[model samples]
Each structure stands twice: as C-alpha cells, then as structure tokens.
Target: MTNVQGMIETCVQCGECVEVCPFYKATGNPSYGAMAKVGAARSLFAGEGLTEEGLKTLWLCTRCDRCVSTCPVGISVPDIVQSARAELRRRGQWPQKCSNIANAIIEHGSPMAAPPQDRITYLGKDHNVREKAEYLYVPGCWASVRLPEVARASFQLLTKAGLDITTLGEKERCCGLFLIDNGLMDEARELAEKNTLLLESTSAKTVITECPGCYDVYKRVYPALFREPNYEVIYIADILKDIVEHGNIEVKHSGRKVIYKDPCPLARRYDMTKAAREVLGHVAEVVEFEEHGAEAVCCGAPAGVKPLYPEVANELAGKLLKEASSKGVDQVGVGCPFCMHHMSGVQNGTEGPLRIRTPSQLMLESLASER
Candidate 1:
C-alpha cells in the first residue's frame, strides 16, 4: 500500500550489485538481486499485488547491503526489502513467523521467545556486584537467552576489572533493532521508550553490551527517540579497550595466535577494527585473516536470511571457517555474539585448525591471570 516509487527510482537497475551479493551467488537467483528485486518492489507502489512467485523473489534477498556499498548510484537495497516486508504486512500478506517474533518482543520485551523471569541470570550469583555498580550490562535478547556463554565471558571480564556493573532484575526489554529490521517501526519506538525509562532508573553512565544490534539501537536510535541526555552505549570490544588503557585488565597469550572476525558494523562502516585489534593484541598474538576489514564475512544470523537461505548462509560461514582453519592458528576471535555463535557451530573442532572465542573471554582470562 505504501509507495516506493521515489526510492526505487534511485536504482539504475545496473547488474553490478548481483555479482557481490552472497545470496545471489550461492542461490543463483535474480529475485534477491539489486536490479530485479528493486524493480519488482517498485511495481507495488502502483498497487500491483505480490504474487506467490514475487513473494519468493523478495524473500530471497539477505538484505546485507553488499549491493548498496558497491552501487555507484547510492540505491539502498536493504531499505527496499524492509519497505517490501512492511507493505506485505499492510496487505495482510506477510509471513506469520515474522509477526510471531514481533509479538514476543511486544509481550515479553525480548525476541528470543523466552520467559521474562530469567532475564538477569547473567548476573551470575554476584548479588553485591550488580546492586552497587556503575555500569549496567545489557547483553541484548539473543545473547542473554540463546548465547549464554559469550554473555558470561563479557560480564566476568568487566566485573573482574573491578568496575561495578549491574542489570535490571526481570525488566530489560528488547533493544528493538530486529523490529526495525522487520519494518515494525511503531513497535520499535515503543520498546525504545520502555528501555530508556529502565536505563534512567538505573542511572548508569555506561551500558556494556555483547550484541552489536543492541549497541546500534541504544546509541543511535534511543537518543533520537528519547531526545534527552541519557546513559552511553559501549560495545564489549570498546569496553575491553577502556579497561586495558586504564590498567584495569591484562591478557596473557600463553603463545595463543588469533585471527579476527570483524563484525561488519565495526570493521567496515565504523572503522573500529583497530581498537578491537589493540584490545585483543595485549592478550594474544594477533593476525589478520583475508576478507577481513570491509570485506569481512558475515555471521549470517540476522535478516532471517539464514532461515530461507540456509545453504547460502552455510556457504558464506563455511568459507570463513575453512579459510581460517587453514591458517594454523590457535584461536579465532569474534566480537559480535551472533557471529561468535554461528562461527562456533561451524567450527565443530575439526572444521578449523583453531577454536572460536568471544573477545570478552580472552579479556576475562587475562583478568583472571593478572589477579
């Protein structure tokens, strides 16, 4: 129902974007490509309904923005995908699974489909630590519920550094990036209001998070929505750097060699890979793997692209594991929890010559050794 003619006009329908899209490359499909899908999505503005074939085409895109980065004309493909999904939802033609996830986020303050009662289990028996803290650690939904180990490491390292950090008891809400990804703009805004109030109650100056999605939303979206002076959002990697720079944490390598898996947010867009390197460099012998930096491999977790395009996701992750494994390293460090989780599964011990670690684990180990 929404018109996308203005946005769609930006795409010149050039075929250059298809060659770089991992989804198109692995599936050999055009529906997910920049030109074809961008063109198809444009028709909806005229009230041309989405057919079964057209739905498959729109769903094929991973929405990773590889095309947007490569496009000479500045057409944003991911925004188009989001608009397409929103239009479908408007027409009552979107996927039920999409709303199911959104429904859980609205009802339970998280997208993990988990009970709200266990949200603060990551506090880890340190009652005095959280109650009298200066930092509030929001591990985000996926990491707090699904990826507990990485969440644990991020906390232990921070706590061990002697910073008083705390989290809400059963009151933390989803940071709402996923909702925005699904084009549920109103819900995303609502979740932000709730989380902003929660942060204000805690009065913590800094929020250390394990998930980049959470960091992106809290730092960028929360301010725009709330439009007030509030707590700062810091990624786990940056926090590690802070601890190291202030002489609060130290890492001993024991001769461990590591290859960095830069989250696309940090490596390409924000250019924070150097800080990530220094954080890990103090602890381990650090090395750069090929396809890192702006060209780094994606964790293939978000965008729901993993579900519909498993083979393509697997291919992208598989290639990274295979390449890193061939490098004869001791460890592969990933900053994003989703990246750490997906890459860890594919490693399977034998798939790589190295083990994958959350960056926080190494920092925690360093803190433990120093003590």
Candidate 2:
C-alpha cells in the first residue's frame, strides 16, 4: 500500500485537521474539513458508496495543506484528497468548470481560453523574443491573459536589471497548477511535458515567474512528477532581494504605508513569507495585517474555488478587504496574481477603502518616481 493510504488507514480521527482548515472554519461544514473528507474517500476506496454530495466535497478542497502541519500522524491530507478526486473523475463525476479548464488548457495551451497570439500581446508588435537568452520568463495564465500589466511590469523590472531576459512568446503553456490542484494529473502531466520540451529548447539557464501558483508548481510539483526541469525555476519575489541589495534595481522610498498579503502557497506551502516581505519593504513602509504569514486568511478564491463557490469566495474576499482596510494603509501589496485579481474585483465593485496592487506594480511606481 502507498504511504498515503497507510497514513489514512492509521489516522486516529483526532480532528486536528478541522481546526486548521480555513474552508471548514468559514463554512462550518464537516465535509469541508480534511478529516471528514479523507474519511469519506477512505470509505469509497474500501468499496463503500458515497452520495453525490459526498463526492462534491472532495472537489471543494483548495489543497492548501494547512491540515498537514497539524496532523499528529503526519498525513498529507491534500494528497489523499487529490487521490479521491482522481477516483471521482474516473467515475465521470467532477466539477464542470474544472473539467472545462482542463479542456481549455489542452485545446488552447492556457486555462483562460486565450489564443496563442494573445500571450504576446502585452509585449507589443515591435518587441522581439530572443532565441538564446540567459533568462526565460513564463508569465502564467493570469498575468499573460487577464492582467497584462503585471507581466509588463515584471518584464520591465528584469530588463532594467541588465539581465539578458526573454519571454517564450506563444510557446509557453500554462504551468498546470490549476489542473494538479483539481486532481487532473494526466492532463497536468501532458501539459507539463509540452512546456518542458519548449523550455529546454531555449538557451536560458533560468526561468522566472511572477505568479506564485506557477512558481510553486514548477519549483515543487513538476520535479516530483517528471525529471527536474532543465533550467532553474525561480519566483520573481525570491530574486528581488538580491537585485535590490546589489543596486541592480533602484526603489525610491515612497513614505506610503503598504501591507503585504502573503499568498497561501508562498507562505504556508513554501515558507516564502520573508522573501515576499523583503520585496515589499524596498517599495514602501511594510505593515502587518491582523492575521499574517502562515496564519493569514485565505483570499476567498485561491484556486478554482471562485468558480465552484462564488458566494463563499466573495464572502472571504469581503472579509479580507475589511481586514486590509482596518490596517489604514494606502494600498495592499499582493504577490500572487490570483489573489490580486479577486481582491481587485472586490475593490472595484464596492470602491473599497484600500487599493490592491501587485508588488511588481508597486515596484514600477518606485521606478517611475525617478522620472
């Protein structure tokens, strides 16, 4: 039996995962917690049938791994949950939107359904993509399709540092974190293989990304699934500390108060709170939100939760926006494009008190100050 199955069978049912789960805490539903969901999956694998609602509960998980730290048995609940999701998918039962996302990624090379040409639209018609460069920037789906400025700002920052950086233009595919999180392993693997081939064809020795989801998948998930990527995978936030310290990039003191919203994958999964904080400190006065770091609140729609449960996602977003407002900051610096997208949705609709800006955008402001 697999280690995950061993852990599941040996689980003491101590309810430790319940206390740390944000979705379970927010919805107050046992099905949303890791303990109940894993037990349900265990029963199904043991030849017991679950109701349709029981199956839906598995897809409801965000795969945050917050429960892993609290489990005395050291069970990786998220892995078990993903295994359950794959079983459900095999039975022709899965979230419709998630399935569509997988199809979109397979058909269009992106989950956003954007065309290949659109990926390079932000680069303008006159810009060129180098065939051989030292760095290759993969601007994931959100940044390349939905938020072009974030991609633009990231490109500008890297170029300003005198690095020989180039983007893949249309060849770069979605990093497939969305599929991996949803238990679409086969789809994720296929996409990752295609991306890996394209990535290796380039002369770049390093690949940089601004999206935390993409960064996490490349740095952590891909290596476990396939051979390590030929080039290094780096999060832009991780490089900012070195770039700023060496005088490669200049960030003027704005004297403005800004609080950083740590992306869940960065803080809880990868422990990147310090790196994100260092990047923010260079641009503005860093302030703390009420709940921060590992304990920070989940931004309502971290993965596909927004499409699966819009009301719940918005509720979490509203609550987080209120928390940011009380901090009395001029703006909130978000490292993840996923979080920034939803937070901006809340900000735009209600014209909320505090503004939401990407850390790269804030850095761009510092660069603009020179003019």
Candidate 3:
C-alpha cells in the first residue's frame, strides 16, 4: 500500500487546487474538487472505505497534477488519488470500465482488445521492418489503433532523416499506463518486465515513442517499478526538432498558423515543453495557449476518465478548442497522440473550424509542399 498519510496531513485546505482542477471546473461538483478527494483518500487509507460516490470522485481525476502545482504545502492530490484507487482495486470495487480496459491490455496486448495482428495492418504490405536496429519506434496503442496517421508520419519523418529505426510491429504490447493509472501495480509491473526484456532483445539502444503516455511509462514509470532501462526513451518531437533544425530534409514554410497544446506528461511531468514548439515553428507560425508549458490545461482524456466520463471529457476538450478558436489559429498542433485523438473526436471532423494535428503530420505537410 502506498502511504499518503504525510500528504494528507500537510494539506491546509486553502482550496487553491479547486481553481485549477479541470474536473471540478467543468462539473462544478464539490465532491470532484481536489480537497474533497484528499479527504476520500484519507478515509480509504484508514480502512473506513469509501462510498460509491467517493470512488467515482477518485476516478474522476485525470491525474494532471495541476492541483499539486497549486497546493501551498505541495500536497500531490494525484498521488493521494492513485493510492485511494489502489484500495478500491484491492476491494474489487473499481469501475467496470477500468476492469474492461485492464483485461483487454492483459489478454490482447492493447486497450482496444484487438488482435496483435491488427497492430501492423496500418504499416501496409510494402513497409520495411528490420529485425534488429539501433532505435525502436513505439507508436503506442493510441497511435497503432486509434491514429495510424500519426505513426505513419513519425516513421516517415525518421526514415527521411536517414536514421536507423525499426518498430516491434506485432510483437509490441501495451506500455501498461492504464494499469498504473488505475492502481493495478502488480499487472503494471508484469508489463514493465515483459516490455523491458523485449526491448533489450532488439539491441536497440534508444526507444523513440510518438505517444506521451508510452514515453512517460518507459522513461519514468518503468524505471521506478523495477530498474532503469538499459535503452534511452525519447519522444518523437525531440527527433523531429533535430531533423527540422539540421536541414537534413528540405521543408517549405506552411502559411497556416497553429496553437500548440502541450500534453501534461511531456510538459509538466518531464519538463519537455520546447521540442514540439521548435518543430512546429519551422513549418508553421506557432501560437501559445493562455496557459501553456508546465501550466498548460489538460485535454481530459487520460487515465480512465474519457472512457468512464465521456461528458466531462468532452467538456474539458471543448474548452481547449474554444480557446484555440479565440486565438484565430489555423489548427491546434499537439505532441501527444492521445491528445490528438481526444481533441479530434470533440472537434468532430477534419474539415472542422478547429483542426487537430501532430507535429510530425504538420512537418510531413511541409515536406510534401516542398516537393
């Protein structure tokens, strides 16, 4: 059990967290507030248990850690909520959506519950997949299943730059971020060990991923759960930034103006807020959100919130789109595939007023224009 008593004892209940919590701001539910979540976590920690409502409150959190930044005492509400969720899992009281996704990842190696064979279909028959390489590109479940275009663009950009990159293809499994988010530590650890072994077998010294969730797990969570990875884990944005800056490939400037939406994991967790901007700046005129970088607002699709609370997720994503529209940009360029998926879903269509695209896709557009 993760002890959060120290965190709970430090809270002064100043309510700073409520002002920044997207869940609380969107739903206006006091129970969904960060302070109330700490209280629920306390109850669960003390073995008093939580009501169904309290459990729902815990799950409502996206773990964006905005509350942590606001708390004067530096109380991490996300950590407390994660601990509370572990208690719920122990009692078999976790929500059905969590259970379904967990089972899909464990049984089928993806949250989509699709067969492993479905993972490689997007690569096309003529795709070249090396058996061993120096860099392994992991598109993650979202890129592999939900948004293949992101994967295609990223892979194409890397190859165009003449880097030695290969993918796991059908042998890849979920990075187990959902398990960690939902407090299924044991299952998450199993996945960490499996993925680490598979990655080591490829003799790849670096693992490059297009998904922020995958990068977070491979770079941060996996090491903490077990040992540090032998290979370095990097985000595709960093690679794209290098490729654009070095002039390895000619890219014409795009006339489109874009607002960059920073993914929480890359911005707040990893302190990586510049790479995507540098890449996007080369191809398009990049704009900023009112709150960006470490303080950027979340897209509200992470963890199990989108699957469990669709309305709240939509409400949160809508906030970003409305803000982008006010900025009068041509589109929103996101560094994370999950953000692209959620924001694009809420935007409704590719030809919609507010467009959502990855940095790689935008760069690909620039490359095509030069041709």
Per-residue alpha-carbon lDDT of candidate 2 for residues 1-371, written as tens digits (9 for 90 to 100): 27657877989999988856767766778777779878878877886888765675676667776778888878888888878777777888777887888788778878778888888877888999888788988888888888888888888888889888899997778888877876788777777677777887887799998898888888888777776888998888877777888999888878898988888888888788887678778878899977788877777685577888876777777777777778788788898888888888877779676868887788888889978
Top candidate (TM-score): 3
* Candidate 1 vs candidate 2, TM-score winner: 2
- Give the clashing pairs for model 2: none
- By summed lDDT, the worst window of 10 consecutive residues in model 1 runs over 124-133
lDDT of 1 by residue, 1-371 (tens): 23455668767777887766656655567665566677668776568876665776676665555566787877777778778877878888767676777787888777666887566666666554344357888887767777777778877777788987787756677887767776777877777788888776788988877887787778777777765546777788888888888878656665677888887756555666777788888888887767677766565656665565566667677777766767777788887877776666666635355677877877777667776
TM-score of each: 0.89, 0.94, 0.96
RMSD from true fold, candidate 3: 1.6
RMSD of 1: 2.7
What candidate 3 gets wrong by more than 4 Å, as runs, is: 49-52, 349-351
Weakest 10 consecutive residues, lDDT, candidate 3? 347-356
Q: Write the per-residue lDDT of candidate 3 for residues 1-371, one digit (tens) a residue.
A: 33488988788878888868888777888778888898888888788958877777898888887778788888889888888888788888878888999999999999989777777766878986788999999999988888888888888889889989899998999999888887888999999999999898888998999898899999989998988888999999998888877888777778889999998988888799999998888888999999899889889888899999988989988888988998889689998888888898988933458768998998898888887
Computed on alpha carbons, the lDDT of every model, listed in order, comes to 0.72, 0.81, 0.86
Best by lDDT: 3
**What order do you get sorting by lDDT, best first?**
3, 2, 1
